[model samples]
Target: MSEQEFTKSLTYAPGLPKDATFYSGHKKRVTSHAVSEAAENALKERGVAVEDIAEIVFDLQTPFMAGLTMEACVENVRGALAKRELQHAILVGIELDKLAEKKMLSEPLQSLVDQDEGLFGVDETIALGAVSSFGSIAATTFGYLDKVKPKIIGRLDQEKHGKVNTFLDDIVCSIAADASSRLAHRVRDQEERRLPKKR
Candidate 1:
């Protein structure tokens, strides 16, 4: 059915469409490329660029992965964000941060998110959730980046532009961590390919 038709069918149920059992995206699956574009756009809107995240990945992996170019790092960063988990995490975190910026969130909860209280660990938790699929390397790198807040992350966390970046900074860190981990795995694959075949 057409999008308009499907949308009009919402009256079948009080709040949901007639057939909520199916995946809405099945007709036009949300492609990785689409997600990549959206994720990058979201970051760009918030003054963060794909290169900003790529720089972190390069810094984290250059010592271990020789001949690693900035272009390669950037591609890997894009590749990582293409995954639904990273896309969702970054989008959700950024939205929350924007909400806090507008002071649209409720009290107490709003204060916690806006102030970025030291005790508030939910930001890191959301970031870790995005990095979890990448394995121990991403997890550890996320922790390291959280502590250092290198590059754009540092600026984001410290900048006071009426914007609350409690979740955004961590989300960026997780993307870098995940990209670094993906680069590492790709390097491993390249090494295995070069090795002599076992008899």
Candidate 2:
């Protein structure tokens, strides 16, 4: 197949008309390249490296997904980052975190976000929306990451990071969770394809 045909095949989903125009302009801007660039820039601005984020994702996913390579895990993270909804979530979450860091919000809300108040969980809730796209496994993985705060995630949450990462941390966790779920699905598909056909 031609490259254009391959690209079209990948993007076409059942029940969604290929010619349907939805957010034509915005969707054009939401390409995989754009999403990856946005994710990288957001991480860099927060004093976190993409490598560190990828490493955390690798560590979080490899244990559950046997035979999954670090490279594959990293690629899955990139794929997760490519989703337009996920890109939007990352941008919104980081903007909220920065606003909270600067105390730009008003009244009790400002105080709640700045202090990382336990009861104030709107940040996580926003991040959770991104996790739902990949199904229940993504949600469970996110819950695990939230509770464990492993590796780079723990560091990002520290006061020494010089910023409130209340939203960013959850956003990262959701990314990793989504990536893990994606990898699991891909692996299962491969395995099923390899099974012997019924006579």
Candidate 3:
């Protein structure tokens, strides 16, 4: 058979194409409200107030992205939380930090977490995984937030706070970083859409 005839003889399966859905339906299956509530409860248990976290999120987002409102930042964070992967990361990172704070880990590991060792990079690594969801802007934003340690992040890092927030700080930073990236992408898309197209 000729190449054209051979190709025509092949039958395609009839079903939904794999690429039909850009995003997994899981994002819709999980509610952002539920995710936000769980995150708030977790933070509260660790002595960080939801309001304080919101403030920090606002601080991280506004400086880089122009005209990004506080409400938008809050919504972005809620949206990020809605991702099941991020939700799992946040819970696991927080719980691991709590365990370290309570001295629940064995010898060397406990010492690393309790002392906040410079070499102990697991916490930041875990948080980094979540940041990647939003692309390169998220990474750069996370670096800035990590360096500045603005607002609640700084408070959480201090020894006087009496709470070991090793992972919590980084996780929150990732959330804020993701939100900032989201805003940047949205604004850029809007601008692109406004531009005239060539014939």
Q: Which model scores highest in lDDT?
A: 1
Flag the better candidate by lDDT, 1 or 3. Answer: 1
lDDT of 2 by residue, 82-174 (tens): 887788888888887798778788988878877778998887898799999999999998999998988778877775444888888888888
lDDT of 3 by residue, 168-193 (tens): 88887887787777777887898999
Off by over 4 Å in 2: 1-36
Cα-based lDDT at residue 160, candidate 3: 51
Residue 77 miss distance in model 1 (angstroms): 0.2
Q: What does the lDDT read for residue 35 in candidate 2?
A: 65
Show the colliding residue pairs in model 3: none
Q: Best-fitting candidate, measured by TM-score? A: 1
Every candidate's CA RMSD: 5.6, 7.2, 9.4
lDDT over C-alpha atoms for residue 179 of model 2: 86
Q: Write the per-residue lDDT of candidate 1 for residues 31-97, one digit (tens) a residue.
A: 7777777888999999998899999998999899879999999999988887888998988899999
Say which prediction, candidate 1 or candidate 2, comes out ahead on lDDT. Answer: 1
**Which candidate model has the greater TM-score, 1 or 3?**
1
Q: How displaced is residue 171 in candidate 3, in Å?
A: 0.6
For each candidate, what TM-score against the reference? 0.84, 0.79, 0.74
